[model samples]
Structures are given as structure tokens and as C-alpha cells.
Target: MLFQVGGQGTRPTFFEMSAAQQLPSSVRAALTYSLGVFALRRPFIHKILDYEDEFFALLMLVLETHSLRTTDASFSESLYGLRRRGAKIKLKKSNLLTNSADEVRHTGLRKRQKVLSVVFLVVLPYLKSKLQSTYNREREANLQASLWGDSDERFDGDFVTGDNNSFGSRDVSNIEASARDRCIKRVRKIVGACYPWLHAGNEGLSFAYQLLYLLDATGFYSLGLHALGIHVCRATGQELMDTSSRISKIRSRERERLRGSPWLKALQGGLLSCAYAVLDYAQTGLIAAVFFFKMMEWWYQSAEERMSAPTVYPPPPPPPPPKVAKEGIPLPPDRTLCPLCLQKRANPSVMAVSGFVFCYTCVFKYTNQYKRCPVTLMPASVDQIRRLFHDV
Candidate 1:
């Protein structure tokens, strides 16, 4: 399936090589993460004072509220009753019937009911207690229905849902400016600590996140936010974001600062690092999948004599075919599309790669070798100068 296209002496392309060619995907992904270093060149700045101001604003709102619960007592009772009766809302109809021992063979209804009861009695009301007036508004949740097929058995009785846990009612009303001061002081100390690259003088964390997000290289930045979000939520005895308007703002700004600090190198260095990271991700995804399946097999066999496997749903239906070429219809016209990102937009460069013209800027941003041709998935190189063809 893979034969080199260039001359014999030239090295084989990345796409042509097997995934064992690189570090394990998980390891590579971990290594690719920016520890506020080696990625972003130009950081974007935000006003941290805005976060401080909003925290106090929110604190006042909470203090003013006579009743923390938005809905009346009757409505609260109704919601509680629904939870007690095991009225678990499965938006996707198929999810309602999933793994039912009678049908799908692994619902674990009794266990699930027990979990639901704990959530309703202990967690649900506490979470509801912290909701802001706006949070009480009707909200729409997105659903992704997929089909999964796995050869592992360990996942048989496991159930997954978005509602993993609920928070309890508490006056996170206590999370104050002292907490804010301490958090900021701690970060300042950490960034300033004994690392040449992580110097606060060299990079602003806020700027780092913005640039990395712009370059689509936000791996650790997001993880940092999630871990910190959990940390803040627990420390304050309520949702961290609910502590106060100002604290919530600080939470956001904190994530922005911490995540952004990566890739905040001098411009050229940042761009090169981003290119390296993204290319690495695309290159390593396959290895991760294979390893995942292997792990599942090992776990399933180890679980018991015949434990059921994790239910992996099948992939959703394929997207409708493009309208560009209907049978027997003429092409509308040659339109410019982003040669790099591939998302068509206005003002694309009309340069050729593999005899097709594309936006030069798009191609400039796109990396070859690691992630090759957009359409064909073949190895690519820029053809800045026209190559001549002749009869031999």
C-alpha cells in the first residue's frame, strides 16, 4: 500500500510509515503539551481587573437573594419527585432502551437507580441552590449519537451520562477577595519559580492562551482549566463560578492566563512550535485508537468469566454528499477555498499543489509530511516555482 514516490535515496514520508514509527500516541500527546513554554510566540493580553470587578458584583447579587432556589417550592418538589421515581431523561430515544438486559443485555438498572437516588437526595438540590437567575432559564443540550463496536467485555455494566454528579447547596458565599489574592499570589510565585522559560517577565499567561488558541494548539491549557475548575469548586464548598461575580470572572481569566502562557515565545519560535504540536497530534491519533482497543481487550478478559463489554455505539450516518457535482450537471465555477484549513472563505490564494490552485497563505500555514494532502492524504511539498513537463 505504501511505496515511495520520490527518488530511491529520499527518505520515506510520514504517512507512508507505520505508527510504531513514533512514540505511543498517549506519550506523544503528553509530550506535545505546552507547559507555558515552547509553543506560542505572540500572546494576547486581557484585563484581569475585569475579573476582580465582576466577582464583587456577583457577591452582592448572592447576598441580595432571599431565596437561592429560582423555582417555587412546588416546582422543586416536582423535580425531586422525578428524580426519586428514576425519571432519568435520555434525550436520545435509543439511549432509553440501551443495554436493557431484556434487550441490549447490560443496563444495570438497580445500580443505576441507586446512583440516581444518591444524586437526587444529596447532590441535585445543592447544585440547584447555587444557580443564578440566568442559569435557571431553559437551556438546550446538544446530543451526539454514535455507533461503537468493541471486542472488550469489561464495559458491559458501565453506564455513562453527562450528569455524572451534582453539587450540594452551600454558601460559596464565603469565597472572598482573600481567596482571590491567595490564588493570584500563588500563580505569580509558581510562574516566577526556578525555570528560565517560564519567566513571568517573558510571558503573560493570558497572552499565551490567546495565541495558542488562535493556532489551535490548546492541549494543556484546557486541561489546566478543567483541573483548576474542579479544584476551585471543591475549595469553596460550592461551584467556584458561583462564589461571586468577581470570583467567576477570575476563574475565567485564570484559565485564560494559565492556558495562554504556552507558545508565548518570540513570534517565529511560537509559530514553529504550534506547527510541530498539531502535526504531531494528527500523526499520533491512530496509535492512540489501537492502544485503546488493546487495553479494552485486556481489561474485559481480566474482569470475570464473562463480563459484558463497554457499549460502543456505531458511528452516525455519513454526511450528505457534496452538491458540487450532481450527476450530469456542469460545475458552477472554479471557486477559491482555503488550501490550508480547507474551510472555504473569501480571499484565498490561487497557487497550485498537485496541479490544483489554492490560497498561498493557506498552504503556507499548512504543514506537510506529518499531515499531508488535504484531499488525497499523500505526502506534499510546496511547489512555489512551476515545474515543466516535456515529452521524452
Candidate 2:
């Protein structure tokens, strides 16, 4: 059975105290929701439009950190005030121990404090985890439709293959495939714009989480040390106030140096702004280079095939008999027949080096076998032959 405690002093009861202690957590939740829905969500519209999700997550992180620090400072101040008030009340109650009402009040306060501690430490964390789980589940369900498309509702079996369908079905399948690809692309863009850190595993307790926690822990540790130092100075009756003032002056000077230096600030800002652009350009260039090299490779393979292909030659005709000529006169040459085949020309072409016309097949076969022109016998190749437009 649970016991009840009643109090009528300056001290608050268990439920009231617990509610007061949870003020920071409540403020943190409100700030997170406000920043996420109002501030970060505004970027989502612009982010989706721009198709660039690179820095939105980083901005969200900065805003979240600022909100957490603000709430934490408030909570710390409130806790310090409560501790000081409690100490004062305890001292007064000790002097009034002879009063029965004072004794009862102290007992009730102690019981209430214990109950409040349990509620805040145990019950609150469990509730927070349950709420987070529910939120994640709902978010996943809503976003899933944007990724998988109507396929989830349509096909219950494996994808069809091997051209076993009618033309209409094939066209329908092609359209569905194209639609599915488009849906996947849209979903990727939305996810990237809304939550860049999701891919980087910073959505939950990750490096960013640990780093922020460490900063808070260090700040609280320093505060604890400062409090301890003050307590020690008071106990020893030492004058350390001047020393602390000097230290503060030094810190202020350092801060001013950091803040006032123009070059350092510019350098930092430039790095932050241009680092992602450089990385993205580098990635795109690398992909383009790979595709360009693949195209070049395919071009080279096609050229090699053309070069190695066998050239077909129609059966060579008998060589014509040399015409006898008078001592000082040369016989007129035949214009209708090819010099290589000694027959009627078929698909005549011309050699660039010797300017001699020959049949296309005859010249290609001769060049492939002998690599020389038939008339001049000069060094010639298949590439030097040009197809003639006129019939021989």
C-alpha cells in the first residue's frame, strides 16, 4: 500500500516538487517540437525544391543544441535555488525541534522528497521511451508509402519474366516499372531533404549525441569545481575573489581575440560553406570519368572489330594480254575494266596516293593482302581508298 504525506510549510509536496523538477524536460520537449515543426519544417519546402539536402541536418543540429543548453541552464538555476531554500528551512526546523508541528513537517517533507525522486528518475524515462517508439512507428508507416508504391497492393507473386505475356500486359508492366523507379527517386529526395543525418546514423544516440552530452557534462563539471573552490575559500578564510576576477578578465580577452579576428572568422566561414560543394563536385567528377572511360573502351573494341574483319574478294579474272605498240607510240588503255581484276569495274573506288581508280572489292582485297597500290606499287592501305561517286 502507498503511504500519503501532507505538508503545510514553505516546502512543496511530492507531486508539486516533481512537476517543478520536470519543468526543464517539458521545456526541452516543447522547444524540440517547435524547432522541428516550425523552423526545420520550413527548410523542408525549400530543401525539396532545391534538391539539395546537404546542410539542413547540420542546421537542425545547431538549433537543437542551442535549445537544450537554454533549457539546461534554466533547470540548473532552479535546482540551485531549491537546494538553497531547502537548506535554510532545515536549519530553521532544527532550532525549533521542540515543537511537535515542526517535527511532523520535517518528516512529511522527507517522505514526499523520496516519492518525487522515484517518480522523476524511474517513471519519466519509461514514458519517454514509449512515446518515442510510438512516434517512430507512425513516421515509418507514413513514409513507407512514398518508397514502395502500389506494387505492395498489386502483385502478390514474384515478378514475371521470359516474355510470357501479351503485348498489353508487357506495356502495363513497363509502365509500372517506370512508375516504381520514379516513386523511389522521389522518396529518396524527401528522406534526404528531411533527415540528412538519418543515413549517417545521427538520427538517434550517435556521435553528435555523445559530443553534445560531453559538452554539457564538461560545463556542469566546471560549475561543480567552481562551487567547490568557493566553498574551500570560505572555509579557509582566504581572499580568492580577486584571483577569480583576474581569471575572468583573461577569459574575456581570449574570447575577444577569437571574436575580433577577421581572417580567422572568414577562414572558418569559408570552410563551412565550401567544404560540401567541393566533396559533391569531386564525387560527380569521379562518376563522369568512369562513364567516359567505359565509352572509350567500347569505341576501341568496335574499331578493333572493324580492323580485324575479313575482306571478301570475288574470284579474280584472267589478266588481259599486253597490247603491242609501235616504237614511239603507246596503246590507249582500257577505261571500262579494273586494273586489279582485269574485268568490268564493280563499285569502283579511287586510291588517294596514286590517284588510280579501281573496283572497291578489288582494291580492298589487294590492300589487305599486299598493302600496295596496283599501278604505282607504292605503300598504300585500306584507309587511303575513297569510294568513287561515278560509275566506271
On TM-score, the candidate that comes out on top is 2
Q: Local distance difference test, per candidate?
A: 0.34, 0.46
Q: On a 0 to 100 scale, what is the lDDT of residue 103 in model 2? A: 19
lDDT by residue for model 2 (97-121), tens = 5653321111112333333433433
Residue runs of model 1 more than 4 Å from their true location after superposition? 1-265, 306-392
Off by over 4 Å in 2: 1-17, 28-131, 134-155, 163-392
Find the 10 residues in a row with the least total lDDT in model 2.
228-237
Number of clashes recorded per candidate: 29, 0
- lDDT score, candidate 2, position 307: 100
Candidate 1, after superposition: displacement of residue 42 in Å? 31
